[model samples]
Target: MSTRSEALLARPAAQLEVRQRITVLLTPPGLWLLLFFVIPLGVMALFSFRAASFGAQRQVFTLEHYQRFLADTSAQRLLWRSLLIALETSLICVVLAFPLAYFLSFRAGPSRLMLLTILVIPSWTSFLLRILAWKVLLGSSGIFNSLLLSLGWIEEAAPILLFSRGAVIITLVYIWVPFVALPIFAGLERINRHLLEAAEDLGSRPWQIFLEVILPLSLPGVLAGFLSVFIPTVGEYVTPLLVGGVDGIMYGNLVQDQFARALNWPLGSVMSLVMMLVVLVLTFGLGRGVKVTDLAGV
Candidate 1:
């Protein structure tokens, strides 16, 4: 009887060891993702289906909130405007980031890490503070105007830089610039310098090399960076609220209003879900176009 008990214990221990090893390789990441991503999405979905009374603390399951979001012309206009602004911001970010990344990868002196760090320093500081800094720099009494006046570039301070679409775009570009750069840098870094050299050796001009070897190789990075910034930028609430006057209030602002002032949770959720689908489609499309988006590197 004692021998049989000992044999059973030994069998379980080996199985437990195998299970532990398998779990060690997979469980931590799975658990973390489940806790953070899945849980938040689940909560959002749950609340999104509920009709919200907000300050009055009343909620009930209903489709009225969603119907209102779809049927209201004002809401649709706001949503369209928000999407357009976000798209503009992303395009600007991509254009600015690509060249900087290209230079950093192909040129910049040997202190590459230092250069990257410097480029990202502005981002390390407070986001709100950065936007405020833009406000001051662009204000009537700001340094930009004073400098122009001192240099005689213009007789008066240009007051055209504040509280408008231009202001919002400039601030957003500044804020999202680093996000765009890092992914591009990562993409460029993964590139094989040898392949670029080979293209050059084959009498490919610098432009040709970029068009053929560099561009294709870096597609993944470009996409990764675009999606990283684009999705969140679409739903941005703060930049629109702060820098955008009448022209700058984006769809995110509408979402906040619907929940807080309008007491419409279902509609907010629908908008959120629609935004998610748009992002997902963009991501998948980008991924398909550049299969390397899933690759370990260029």
Candidate 2:
């Protein structure tokens, strides 16, 4: 073969080899996701349309679960309540986390790693254990009530502390702040210090600089934090189950009841699918909205 023709043939062979190597590298994780995530999701999707049977097994397919969920007033209320609580939790986490994130990113000096370690320490413990600790702290005879009694701040140990919506919200906020703040801190750290200096050089006040430079740049972190907190909070069962009392019960609790107590797999699968869809929709919608908002403001 001519030298040029031989080089052309070699190039295609090299490209094929590279493509094969890339596919081999990606195949394992792709198969893992297919086995663990995609297959289960497919099964759940198929089962969502199946009928729930009691004493006798039903081999028929139906939309009874989805229809019932849509038509039932209590179920609808629970869905809305879950959405509201998750939104509120995300908002509060952002508000509380921003300052801490900013400080950690800009002002922590040599202790930044140490402070971050402290923030993450709680997460190393079991989630249920943390919730149980909150239960103890907020119980009528718990430390909070005891302190109030000793200080004469309350006439008696308040009965509304544990098993209340407030307790649920408080516990959620405590658990999720680290998830939100760490992302925000990472986003803040990526911001160029020169930009802030240039904003100040232009006679921008601190607030102006933050609004113009810092906030806009840190948005990726903020959005990440919101998603991390909001998505899981919407499906939160444990915190609400333990501390929410009757009033604080959320959509997830209902789903859990269907699977565990009611033995209604089809119905539970429907609810789980619905929750997953909502999370997916919110993720795309909020991400687009954030991009638009940033562009419009800028």
Candidate number of the best lDDT: 2
Model 1 scores a TM of: 0.81
Stretches off by above 4 angstroms in model 1 are 1-36, 54-60, 147-159, 289-298
**For every candidate, C-alpha RMSD to the true structure in Å:** 6.4, 5.6
Please estimate how well model 2 matches the true structure, expressed as its whole-model Cα lDDT.
Answer: 0.86
Worst 10 residues of 1 by lDDT: 289-298
The TM-score between candidate 2 and the true structure equals 0.88
Q: Which one is best on TM-score?
A: 2
lDDT of each: 0.79, 0.86
> How big is the positional error of residue 267 in model 2, measured in Å on the Cα after superposition?
1.6
Q: TM-scores of all models?
A: 0.81, 0.88
Residue pairs of candidate 1 with colliding backbone atoms = none
State the displacement of the C-alpha of residue 221, model 1, in Å, after optimal TM-score superposition: 1.0
